[model samples]
Target: MQSQPHVPGFTIRLADAEGGQEQEGAPKATRGFRRRRRNRHGRGLRGELMLPNLPGFRSRSERFDDMVLDSAERLQDMWGKQLDGVLFAVDEIPPNLEQLVAEGTAAPMGSCTPGGRGEAPMVTVYRRVVEQTATGREELQDLVHDVVVEYTAEMLGVPPETLDPVYRRRYQ
Candidate 1:
């Protein structure tokens, strides 16, 4: 048995016939380059964070975050399957969402990687900025819709005559 110098929780061990990841009597390896799969609803080991208690109170920040995520997903759902049909740019352009999925980046947006680009152009609502600007969820939703619609309209090369009436009123 050989151990490397000054490295924590790393060791080389003989493989077992059963092929278990753990080596009998060997110290467990620390987390290395890994890509964990998050379950649907965005919950998984990677979700193990102590979020601020919203308990009965959906604070402006929480609402903003939820709405931004929901709207972003919906935008993609409405158009992403078509490939490059909709462009979703966050504060800045995110890397290829398809590639991020393959590479295992859980929250690519948070990582500052643009969400999508191709078809209709999209402007992502920044959670931090939206929350800062909004007084509640309803407000945040409007803001996100406004930004998206505006960006989409620009890409459409139209005067937004086709935009949802609600968004037109809320944003314009």
Candidate 2:
């Protein structure tokens, strides 16, 4: 390396022969490399995700929408009628529900049982439990589906296949 005589009190800048930040002798593809692409839903697609609403879960995607459906839809599809609208406990869930909530807080799932005569069945769904259990929307959806199907069937005292299969077909 040749050391040019230093000019006193002068700041010197060196420019790379190649473009900025490229490794030495790196092959240059076209300057017009693709940046990225976003669909109407604002979700980015690299190759083959097949997801519709990329940025947000809700949108025109059938899969995403199905994931968001309430447990009522599961019962309605299975039994051919919507079970009374889904109700969750505003108060804290019982100990039994805590275990289930540990499974998923975002999609916490549970059911209410009858307190006594004139008291409605308390199909309790623990939101905190579900949230704690879930990692993301997809996981939450799956957790909700599994918990709802299992809990509802248990409350009705029927085999899962007896009710679950019917609704699974309808929703699918």
Candidate 3:
């Protein structure tokens, strides 16, 4: 007798009729078994099973949103109360700026808005632009951190290096 590997949820038995070898003149009808597929649920052409959504399965936009939030959190930790009044936002694209448009300035990965009339200062990061510019995941992460640092610096009227001392070291 030959050994068969154990398979979970399935049972196997040897056929004593032919002893796992084809007969020289076996009938074609007895070669294989045919049965219509059926289940407790409705049945027709029951195709491949669809997998349920699992944890860690995030959409592209959702992942980008998380990256933006994470960068903001890192900045808040670094700058402390200095970032309390600033609002961080992530959008698919940057808003059209009439002045910049008239000047023919290209689209930016991020932009900082100064507040007025009871509004708080805002930092806006453009998701599509940044994602398109990065060559890979690591590059995307670095670019995102750089954009956030740049925007925070702009909001605080300081240079990017001053915002985070280790900022330039990340790229190197």
Q: Which RMSD does model 1 reach against the true structure?
A: 18.7
Instruction: Find the candidate with the highest TM-score and give its number.
Output: 3
C-alpha TM-score for every candidate: 0.38, 0.42, 0.62
lDDT of 1 at 143: 71
Candidate order, TM-score descending: 3, 2, 1
State the weakest 10-residue window (summed lDDT) of model 3: 10-19
Q: Against the true structure, whose lDDT is highest?
A: 3
TM-score of 2: 0.42
Better of 1 and 2 by TM-score: 2
Question: Tens digit of lDDT per residue, candidate 2, span 1-172?
Answer: 1111342322111212111247769896543222346555786655644344465433323332244244445455446433443332322234555564677643334554643564433444444456567788666676656666766667667776776664344335
Pairs that collide in candidate 1 are 84-118, 84-119, 85-119, 85-120, 93-114, 94-113, 94-114, 95-114
When superposed on Cα atoms, how far off is each prediction in RMSD? 18.7, 25.8, 23.2
Rank the candidate models, highest lDDT first: 3, 2, 1
Worst-scoring 10-residue span by lDDT in model 2: 10-19
